[model samples]
Target: MQIEQQAAIVTGGASGLGAATARALAARGAKVAVLDRNADGAAALAREIGADGQAIGIGCDITDTASVLAALDAARAAHGSARLLLNVAGIGTAKRIVGKDGAPAPLEDFERVVRVNLVGTYNVTRLVVAEMVKLAPLADGERGVVVNTASVAAFDGQVGQEAYAASKGGIVGMTLPLARDLAQFGVRVCTIAPGLFLTPLMAELPQAVQESLAASIPFPKRLGKPEEFAQLAAAIIENPALNGEVIRLDGALRLPPR
Candidate 1:
């Protein structure tokens, strides 16, 4: 879909990869809604984007039906129904299945991760997709596209990452199934599994730890920039035939188990 003047929804848009994507989408002329749990942060970004009609930021909880619906209502009220949905909201808290003392991890811990990452992605997707099919297809019966964020951990699954990895793996596992389910409506689904990135928090780590992480990447020997992820998302949006695929944006790096 041509991004210019189109409406797009980006969850987790208050910071990290989501923030970068929201900015990139707006730069391309798409009126964007920045959906995030950080109400103040989201509002700040909307102001920064100069609500000159280009963006609106709404506080949203991806796992709650009422919250998400309210967010969508606010976004639609600001822009029109969105034709592009970017599922970037997720949590990455880590915990091992068993503690060093040998006690099993709490089930709620695992469930929370799954609920926020996998189920959250689906919650927003279902609502946005419903609105998408109502839109008149852009030429060739193409109505919309969904871009989901997964993580390289889904494949490598280092120790202490059971909850986080399981959540992401669920996203990778469902890409094709989601695409197939929405095919009849001309809405496509795709996923991106990114490697380590230099987000603000990561940038605050000690230099030695940062260097060690950078050295692990196969090529470029560095953590990824948020803009790089956004660029790939923009490319996927513009390409009509790219669907049901999970592209690894890890610079050819396959992580070793910790």
Candidate 2:
């Protein structure tokens, strides 16, 4: 799509890959709505890309239906109908189903992870996709595209990552089915499974742990950058033919069993 005339909604837009993607989309002339729990950060990003009135920020909680509906409305108010949807809000934690302290991992914690990473992605996509289906198609009869965030843990989760891995795996598993369901409407769905990236969580690791993680990648020998992720997102937006696939942005890294 010629991005200038396009409108996009990005969840988790307050920071990391989502923030980079919002900037990249704006740079390419797409109007963007930044949806995030961090209102201050989202508002700041919106102001940064005020040119052509292309960006706005909305406070959102992806796991809540009412919050999501309000945020979608806010996006439409700023950018008209959304043609691009990026699902990037998720949480990660490491706990075995059976913990070392003889206490089983709480079901609530597992449910929370699934709620934000799996159900949350589904919530925003379903809401925004309804709008996309209503939009007039591009020259190729394409109405919209969706990019969802998964994690390499889904495939090669280290020990103690049961909840996180399951959540991301669900995200990955939904891609193909969603694509098929949305095909008639020309809305493509894809997922990205990232390895160790230079995101906030990884950055907080001890230097030694971080270094060990970087060394595990087969090539590149470093952490993935948020901009690289944004680059892939831009490509997915531009290429209508790419759909129903989960692409890994892990620098050829298959994690080891912890």
Candidate 3:
């Protein structure tokens, strides 16, 4: 799947990982549609990349089917159907299934996490695949590619991360099956499980806490950068052989139980 001249949709494109991906895809010469709930932020980014003349910003709530459909329609109108789907919009709220008081956590807490991270990912992927199937296949019969975002917490979840972990774990678990399901359609699916990184949310932490987390990494001894993740995504798009795998971007660090 060549990134050049292709229509790419990036969820959560307002900031963090999605933002980085939008910039990366644009740098690679692809027409990018920035889909995010932050309407102003998304529009700002599209303008930032407007030099390419193929970038558009759409406000969307991936958890809602109608919202996603509207966004997809807007993206299609702006730049044809998307050939690259990047599912990076997600919430990371840490909560224990059982609070310190031992009372069961509110059901909404769990559902909210899954809805935004897991269900939202599927919503975008499903709609993107529907469009990709309609596009003619390129070399090697490849029509499109989907890259989902997960977290190391899915495997090394600590205390107070039950909901978050489960949501990400669902992403990792679905990778292979999704790849297989889309294989016949010449579509590929893969996931990225990133470890502690200096995203905007992490940047909000105190310096001491940030340093502590960085020190925890075995090598490099620093947080992962959004650009590094984008680099990997570009590689994945360039290499068709990469599919149906959850590649971890942690710097040789296995999170400890908190």
- Candidates in order, TM-scores: namely 0.98, 0.97, 0.98
Model 1 misplaced stretches (Cα beyond 4 Å): none
Locate the minimum summed-lDDT window of 10 residues in model 1: 44-53
Per-residue lDDT of model 2, residues 19-113, tens digit only: 98899999998999999999899989999975767899889999899999998888888778898899988888998898888998899999999
Give candidate 3's total backbone clashes: 0
RMSD of 1: 0.9
Residue 145 error, candidate 3, Å: 0.6
lDDT values, one for every candidate:
0.92, 0.90, 0.93
Model 2 scores a TM of: 0.97
Worst 10-residue stretch by lDDT in candidate 2?
1-10
Rank ordering of all candidates by TM-score, starting from the highest: 3, 1, 2
Model 2 misplaced stretches (Cα beyond 4 Å): none
Better of 2 and 3 by lDDT: 3
Residues 136-245 of candidate 3: C-alpha lDDT, one tens digit per residue: 99968999999999999999999889899999999999999999999999999999999998899999999999999999999889999999999998899889999999
Across 109-216, the per-residue lDDT of candidate 1 in tens digits comes to 999999999999999999999999989988879899999999999999898899999999999999999999999999999999999898877888998999999999
28 Cα displacement, candidate 3 (Å)? 0.7
